[model samples]
Target: MRISTFEYFTSGVSTMNNQQASLSNLYAEISSGKSLQTAADNPLGAAQAVALTAQAANLAQYSTNQSSALTSLQQEDSTLTSVTNVMQSIQSLVVNAGNGTLNDTDRSALATQLQGYRSTLMTLANTTDANGNYIFAGFQGGSKPFNDNASGVGATYAGGPGQRQVQISDTRTINVADPGSAIFQSVSSNESSPVSSGSAANTGSGTIGPVSVTNSNDPANSSTYTITFGTTTTGTPPTTSTVSSYSVTALDPATGTTTTVTPPTPYTAGDNITLGSQTVAISGTPASGDTFTVAPANTGNVSDTDIFTTLDSLVNALKQPADSTSSLATLQNALTTAGTKISNTYNNVLTTQTAVGGREQEVTATQTAMQTTSTQTASNLSDLVSVNLPAAISQYEMTQTSLQAAQQAFAQIQKMSLFNYLSS
Candidate 1:
C-alpha cells in the first residue's frame, strides 16, 4: 500500500494534535481540581452535583431556621420561669392572708404587698421577646397580655388564646408559648360555690319576722350558727311576745304571742320552719339567693361574689370596725378559694414546661437526622465530580511526553531528502 507524503504528514499532525489535546485536558483537570469542568465533560456527574449542591443549600437554610427556633424557645422558657416565680409569690401571699391571727391591720399590710406582687406578675405576663413581641399574647404580639384596674378589682387577661409555634425543621413545627390567660384563669370544680337563697324568722321574741336576704348575702359568712325558738305558733296575727335577745321569736297566728323556732344552716331552696322552745342549728350563715323571696320581713339582699373579690372586700372591711363577723368569714372562704386557684395556676405552668421540653427534644432529633443526611449526600456528590489531584498530574505528564515524541518523529521524517537516499 503506497501512501502519499501529504497524507502521511497530515496523519502525523493529527496524532500530535490529539496527544496535545489530551495533555491539555489533563492539565485543566489538575488545575481546576474538578474531573468535570463543564456538563459536556461528565454530563451525568455534573447534573448530580448540581442537585446535591441545591440540597446542601436547602439544608443550610434549615439549619439556620433551627438555630433561630431554638433561640426563641429558650427565650420563651425563661419568661415562663419568671412567670412561675411570680405565681409562687402570689400563692405565698394568699397563705399569709389565710392565718386568722393576722389582724385587719396585718392583713391590710399583706394586701398592699400582694398588690405589689400582682403588679410584678402583670409585668411578667406581658413580657416580650428580643423581637419586642409579647410572648404570651398569642398572634397579637403587639398587645399586652394582662390588664388591670390597679385598684383591687383584680387583673384580667386581654390577649388571645395560646397559639405560638416555632419551625424547628423543614417539616416540623412546635408550640413555643402557652397563653397567660389559660394558665391563670382556669376554674376548678372545687372552686365553684353553688347558688342558694332563702328567708328566715325568729318567732319567740319581740318583733320576730321572716328575714329576706339576697344572693350577695347568702351564706353571709363562713361561721356556722343556729336559730333558737322559745314557743310554737298557736294561732295567727298581732302577736306580742317576749324573747331573749339571742332567741329568734315568731308571731303566733291565734294567740298574738311570740313563738320560738330553730334556723337551719345552708338553708336550701325549699326549707320551712316553726318556732319551738329550743334553739335550731344552721350550718351556714343566712344569705339570699338569686330567686329568694319573702312574703313580708327584712329586705336586705346579697349578690354573687367570687373569692378574689371577697378577699379584697374583706381587706377593706377589716379597716372598718362595723364589718360583721359573717363578712369576715366569707372573706376567709374566699382566701381559701384563692389559694386553690394559685396552686392550680402553678401546676399549669409546670405542664407547659414539660411540653416545651418535649418539643425541644423533637427539634434536636430532627436537626440531627437532617445534618446526617445532608453530609452523606454532599460526600457522595464530591466523589462523583471532584478530581483526584495526584492521578490527574501523572496522566498529564504521560500525555505531554507522548506529544513531544510525536513532534520529534515528525521533524525527522520532514528532513528526509533525495541525497540522503542515494548515499545509503
Candidate 2:
C-alpha cells in the first residue's frame, strides 16, 4: 500500500490530538475531584444530584420553620407558667377571704391583693413573643388579646377563635399558641356542690347553706330547684295556728321542663330540705312568700365560667358588709363560686401548658429526624458525584503516559516524511 505524505501527517496529527484530549479530561477530573463535571458526563447521576439538592433546600427551610415554631411555643410555655403561679396566689387569697372571722376591712385588703393579681394576669394574657406578636391572640397575633373592660370588672377578649399553627415537617403541623378565651373566659368548673342563694327580694331573715350532694349520679343534679315559702293554717278559728311551710319547684333547662316537685312541707329552722340528689339547710326564720334557689354549678354556659368575672364579683362582695343574715349568705356564696372558678381556671391553664410542652417535644423530635434525613441525602449525593481519588489519579497517570508516547512518536514520524528524508 502506497501512503502519501499528506495522509501520514494528517493521521499522526489526528491520533495525537485524541490522546491529548483524553489526558486533559483525566487531569480535570483529578484536579477538581469531581467525577461528573456536567450533565453530559453522567446524565443519570446529574439528574439525581439535582433532585437531592432540591431536597436539601426543602429540608433547610423545614429546619428554619422548626426553629421558629420552637421559639413561639417556648414563649407561650413560659407565659403560661407565670399565669399558673398567679392563679395559685389568687386561689390562696380566695381561701383566706372565706374565713368567717375576716371583717370587711380585712376582706378589702384581700380584694386589693386580688386586683394586683388581676393586673398581672391581664399582662400575662396579653403576652407578646420576640417578634412582638401576642402569643394568646389566636390568629390575631398582631393584636393584644385581653384588655380591661369599661366596667373594670373583667377583661375583654378581641382575638379570634382559631389557634395558630406552624409547619414543622412536610406532613406535620403544631399549635404554637392558645386563645385567651380558652384559657381565661371559657374555663370549666368541677365543683360538685350546687350553688344556693336567697332571693334578693326576700324580706325574710332566712339564710340557706350550700347544697350538699347526696347522690352525685342522680339525674336531678342537673335541675334548678326553687324553694317557695308559704304560711299554712291548721285548726279551728279560735285555736287556729299558722305553720311556716315551703314547696319545691324544679326546672330542667336541658329539656325546658318546669314542674312542681313536691307538696308543701312544714319548715323548721336548721332543718335540711331535700332537693333532688342534694340537700340545703334553712337556718333562720323565713317569712311567708320568701324564696331561695339551688342551681348546678356547671350550667354548661360560657358566661357562667369566666374566671375574671368570678374574681371581680368576689372582690366586690368582700368589700361589702356581712352584718345581716342575707348579706352573710351572699358573701358565702361569692366565696364558694370564686374558689370553684379559680381552681378550674388553674386546671385549664395547666392543661394548656401541658399541650404546649407536648408540641415542643414533637417539634424537637421532628428536627432530629430531619437532621438525620439531611445527612443521609447529602451522603447519597456525594456518593453519586464525588470522584474516587485513588482510581482517578491512577487513570490520569496512565493517560499522561499515553499522551507523551503519542507526542514522541508523532515527532519521529514528522521527521521521516519524504521531504525531510530528501533533506537528510
lDDT (0-100) at residue 147 of candidate 2?
76
Alpha carbon lDDT of each predicted model: 0.57, 0.83
Please, what are the lDDT tens digits per residue for candidate 1 over residues 51-150? 9888888888888777776776777677778867877777777777767677767877876776666666667778888888888887678888767647
Highest lDDT against the true fold, candidate: 2
TM-score of 2: 0.84
Give lDDT tens digits, candidate 2, residues 168-210. 7889978888999988886533433566766756766787776
TM-score, cand. 1: 0.67
Candidate 2 clashing pairs, residues 3+ apart or interchain: none
